[model samples]
Target: MRFLRRHVDAVYDALTVRRSRFVRVEELVIRAAGVVPGLVPTPQEIAAEDGSIQRDKSGLEIDQGLFLSAVLGSERCGRHLCHAMLLPRPEAQALLAQFERDGRVKLDGASVHRAGKAAVVTQDNPRFLNAEDQTSLDGAEICVDLALLDPTTEIAVMRGAVVEHPKYKGRRVFGAGINLTHLYHGRIPFVWYLQRDLGYVNKIYRGLAFADDAPPDEFGGNTIEKPWIAAVEAFAIGGHCQVLLVMDYVLAERSAFLTLPARKEGIIPGAANMRMPRFTGDRIARQAVQYERRLDCDSPEGRLICDEIVETGEMDAAIERVVKGLTNSGVVSAAGNRRAFRIAQEPLDMFRAYFAVYAREQAYCHFSPALIANLERYWNAQSRKP
Candidate 1:
């Protein structure tokens, strides 16, 4: 509540102008994120004791909370969707800086390809079916950064790499979720969760792309404020499924399914706890998250999460068609209307309220003894080393 008061006036001032609300909101976010350096640990700082990774933190820093409070608590921005609260200057610049560093580091797990106005960002870690490790997550972060910065990109597409395995043959995998092997050994860092929220997922939902660029209305820039389409080939599990909730459209293969194994893993599945209810309503979202129900893309509940399901090997055609159709109308108007719908469907306060519960509960989930027990029984992390 105190945080709300400190930032409310600034939010009001920004929204008073026509299309400048996003700029104002972003500046606020950048300032907030910048000040929390000590609170925000890097991967190394919070890795588990065994030199691997596991969920283990009752977080003290509230980066998400501070930013959301300002945006949602302010009567003006809350009512207006803060002009889509698109990428702020600091967040975009941070990703840009990381991109420079990433090329030299060469994670090589993610890439962005631009063809004309359409761009595709792919996860390429084929060995683990594109499961997120520190490096792949870093790749995902930079890919979104590039897509957000590229002014030519109209409709951004996110997909995964295909690999030939002795076991699976020629199948392409979208994402296998988190790298549980790392989790079992306690190598996964707490910072991964923070970045997932503030970096990529927030960037996608808020429509932020280029830092400190002219508003899309003034310069006709591509802010990723337009639309995002996700193509899921095999399965989206746990954190991967959480990611789908943020996408504007989800396209999956006929056999693809989504699941949140967070209950079994004993960790919160990113923002799924909050966003899932918006799509599947309260009862259904609870069943999936709490009971570990698998949602097939073709099922009624799955269709709610995935906008469309295509036959195997036909995802490419479907993506092209959707991108062409969405872009044919010109993205400027679409961006504006998206903001309007966002304000109506999800006010900032609602999301802000959710984080209050999430931040506290997730910390407990991270340190739970049950997490290790479940991994041993279900994943056999002790023997299989996965």
Candidate 2:
């Protein structure tokens, strides 16, 4: 917990320094605060909000909360208070400008400090390797120095599962469910039918079906019957099978997660649709919708969906492959239409699998006193007024 707190404090300091690493934090906080609604605040708006501090002059000092509120606003607030406090900014505007002109952000010997130890992370902002950099590797390459505090190397490695794979290029895709689940299950006739038919039968079959090897009487019941019938009804009545038909539309074209049977389930399929496109291109959107198919590494469609699949059974190895691939290929080079889509899609699948495992682990594992204490502290702090 102390280590986590230190990371939070570091984020606050970095934001004040206007380091670009905090850019993500600033964006998150601003979005949480609902200060600008759908848009981000401009540099001018940020300056005005924070009492017109002179750019890069460092004269003004603001309370941590006030500074955060101004930059991130209230709408984007979240439980990750430390992250919200830090925002990433360009280290040097001149360098940024040059990168923009050259279509990349290149950094040299820039350090990412974590726990306490610092290691050379990379030599450059990998984004510099667009088609333009085909000949000149000397000027385009940049290096990074990473510092990890309290360095739990294993956890750091695990975290890379999310960070190393860009949403667009990875084979596994991860995403959260929209409100559609509640809408479908919580609605009127649907709820009644499910409770009466599927819920009751599933419970009874659990007790009796295995023992008798009999086809459970509740197996083909009303709940299943009605929604599917209703789906057809919906298509006829509303010109679509469901209010969230967009889910199916997205999954079929852009994602490879359909390779797993678990992902093929109706509810999760919708969530996959929403997240897949953010990683893949619009060209795949049409294909996903048209086919409503799931793809795997061995499938012909998988090749089209992702260039390479990290096939290691171990999660850590798979993630390492992704990180090495991205770093070596250069973030920018990997982010083109073809590669970026693959990176983006894999995480959604990984996250979905991870969460399922986590849920089961939570049900079985015991909590440490330190973890409980941290949870209590977090709840208490959240209970306090701002």
* Model 2 agreement with the true structure over 127-148: per-residue lDDT tens digits: 2111111121122112110111
Worst 10 residues of 2 by lDDT: 226-235
Candidate with top TM-score is 1
Error of 2 at 1 (Å): 51
Clash totals for all models, in order? 8, 63
Candidate topping lDDT: 1
lDDT of 2 at 119: 18
